[model samples]
Target: MKLIYVFFFFCIINQTYGQQKELELIHNCQGRLSGFATVKVIDKRDSSGKQMIGIVQKGALNKPVKVVFNGELTDSLAAFFIDQSANSNPLPLVLILNELFISEAIDNMTEIGRFRLSLRLFIGKQSDQYSEIVAIDSLYTVKGLDVTKKLLRSISEQFCKISQLAAEKQPILDTDAEKYTFKQLHYLDSLEKMKLPMYQTDHPSVGLYKNYKEFKQNTPGVTAELSIEERKNGFRVYIWDEKRKNKTKLPSTGLYAVSDGTTLLRATPLGFFKILKKGGDFYYWRPQVNKSHHSLVPAAYMYGALGGLVYGLIEAASAGNNKWLLQKINYRKGSAAPVSWTTAKEN
Candidate 1:
């Protein structure tokens, strides 16, 4: 009875003192970068010299370009930048802003109204998020650059600040199933329906295996078959091992990513692929490079002529043609490696 009382007392003391509980680890997230995607609206001058608005629902920039926001309100604007961030490597976050708007504030600069140059930023990363309306720079004391230049500078500066925050905070990310959210719901709906334009490959269908035995009959190591099934309207990936007699199915989205070492294009190039080397996030594969003749400029004009030629060829041989095999994607950059096919076939 005495021992029981002593144990109960100890338990009560522990609870009261807030001791013995395991400490929760707070991961510091770092890295901040900002890229600009053009907004889908058009601005034009009317016959009367007044500004007009046009809408291009399916328009976008060739690629996401880096943007910098300058002036007094840079930090406030950048607070909304979003990008690909992982907890393990948090110092270099690059948030690609899909839509940027710089409004005309001349209409309300009176005593009762302050027409400060305000801005709005929107991003699409499987979710939608935007920054609140903040008055960064007052038009009354504007500087050398115009509204467009100021907006870009401010946006970029905001990103640098976020990078610093990531370096200091190191916020950890949850798994795909964890459903971590940083985006606002209003833009999320628009982002979900947005899809980039892509190219169709010559070889659309690439497989026909009913089961593991059917696909694993004669492959060497880990055999993966990627195919586009037109009838089912889905892309499929199958993986199997010869010795273990086991198979695993990886998720697929009915399309293959092709690249040009500078961009990621989509196409189903029907050819055998190998598991060359695996990296932390990307499966490196040989991309096809086409050395097409752009107007023959002097060697000196194109990277010092002979030196430039050698450099281009070498680049094509290395990262230029290397493509990333991702879990999912719609529109990829042109920075893909060259395209090529090998003879490592599957059963």
Candidate 2:
């Protein structure tokens, strides 16, 4: 019994030692945020399905620990900005944190951290929102022996930098923000709805859609000879170069979706998805499975419907004010249907 007890004790110690540690984000702002008196942050990351703000390596085993905000991310962010905007002045700001993800990897014994943060800055409070002044969707990478610490420091710096950029937006700040009445807001909303291009289902335009706006407009930016090439992992869009008499792989950075008049494939953060069905205010899509590619990356990366900025725009356009509410694009795994879109949350 004593032997068993000792073994159990040792096991407990090992488990405790190996357990991943969580780090709280500490904001170290060098300067104050000018022009904004108060700050409010709206947490919109629930839709992305990625709750972990960052991951850090801890202990001798270098176990990957999930880094989280001490309290709510929104609260932390708001506090960070409010602390920076201590003596701030005229406008109240609303920061809608769309996505915040940090990933860590060890390359050649050097720790590397990658951060992708997406946020939109509104001129007023959440309920009494004035107008979106700035949108920042950016990716940052840092490499060091203590990459996690460096990454955190970088994030803190970014908080200050973002605030400075917001301060420099003189066009909006100089105008009468209070004069932005509901009638003007309605007019703007109506104008956006009018900008939503009609999707002609009968004869949908064929080719590469640079953005959702292009797709809605039914005018593909790239009408070149393009095809979906099956890759070792999944599928990629390739455009045939008539001059070269060869096909060039189209980079997925700016491309939104590609249609062949018969099938519509939407681009998510992960890969392209074959849109299976379109229903009321929602479009269903599943990952394009390659039978030959047995080893596929986990579907977690492909969870979000659209990328950062695009998703934000889509959400705004799909609100009740807009005539088009085709908000969600579902993506599901294993099932006959497409995988669910991470951004398919109800408003």
Candidate 3:
């Protein structure tokens, strides 16, 4: 019994050590592209159809390798190429590329037999040049042309769906045109200066203004105002007439009002108003407004739907490849083999 207990304890220690080592390896492995090569796509369906070519880069990450496509195509097709470039915001093309390459690497590493690779190809009907994703095996042989073609077709269909949805939910100006009016009284009790109108009652709510005097001095066409008031309930705050004519009313109640100069209003559930002013005229504005149609939830959903469709198209395209080509290459499933090389070439 003593010997058996000792053996079990040793096994547990070894298992824990192995798990820790695996976790460290995965955490430290930075995905880096080591090499890249170009491959041409042959059109078996349409012998005279325009040919597609793309470059595939090898990387350490067990994901689909980067495949860049560029060629003559229509405006819409051309836009996809532009979208692939890095931008201020997240680009759908970049996301798609990342998903395709990452998923491919994962699938390859797992040795999953029933995995699919899709690559969406954007093409213009009038252009001779087209973009595509090229899948190469360990031997650097092309094995994913047919799958890419099918994926492109699916992506085109999904794009049409998203376009239709956008047309239906086109933002309307009147949707945000509701106006609010608030009034308050201010009494001046100072003995120093005789009050012309002993007490002036201006809606404390109206006192709300954006302070942008410094901004106006530094940046042309930039102004801000702030209207503050002491009311019976508490302090009333309003930030009015910023660059975009945005108005925010903060009262003692939990509810807050936010509006653009002319239209577009929002109410928040939070009672506290915190404003962070940055730069000359640019300020980060957060307001509590009514839960209305233009709320963040609806906008997020719209973007998510469109994003999902794009992702789906790219995933579908990654799966396309000519069966003839795959067979000729004798493509076999296996994880990306570890590559080791020194950086002496760079020196």
lDDT of each: 0.27, 0.54, 0.24
Candidate 3 deviates by what RMSD?
26.2
* C-alpha lDDT of candidate 2 relative to the true structure: 0.54
Candidate 3 runs further than 4 Å off: 1-65, 72-74, 77-103, 108-154, 175-347
Winner of 1 and 2 under lDDT: 2
Task: Write the residue-wise lDDT of candidate 3 on 267-339 in tens digits.
Answer: 2233322222211111122221111112223223544554334334433443332111100000122121211
lDDT digits (tens) for residues 7-60 of candidate 1: 543443334331111111111324433322222211111121111111011101
TM-score-sorted candidate list, best first: 2, 1, 3
TM-score of each: 0.20, 0.54, 0.18
Best by lDDT: 2
Ranking by lDDT: 2, 1, 3
Candidate 1 has a TM-score of 0.20
**Residue 40: error of model 1 in Å?**
22
Model 2: CA > 4 A from native: 1-23, 33-36, 48-50, 55-65, 83-87, 106-110, 125-129, 164-204, 210-218, 224-256, 266-347
User: What lDDT is reached at residue 93 by model 2?
Assistant: 70
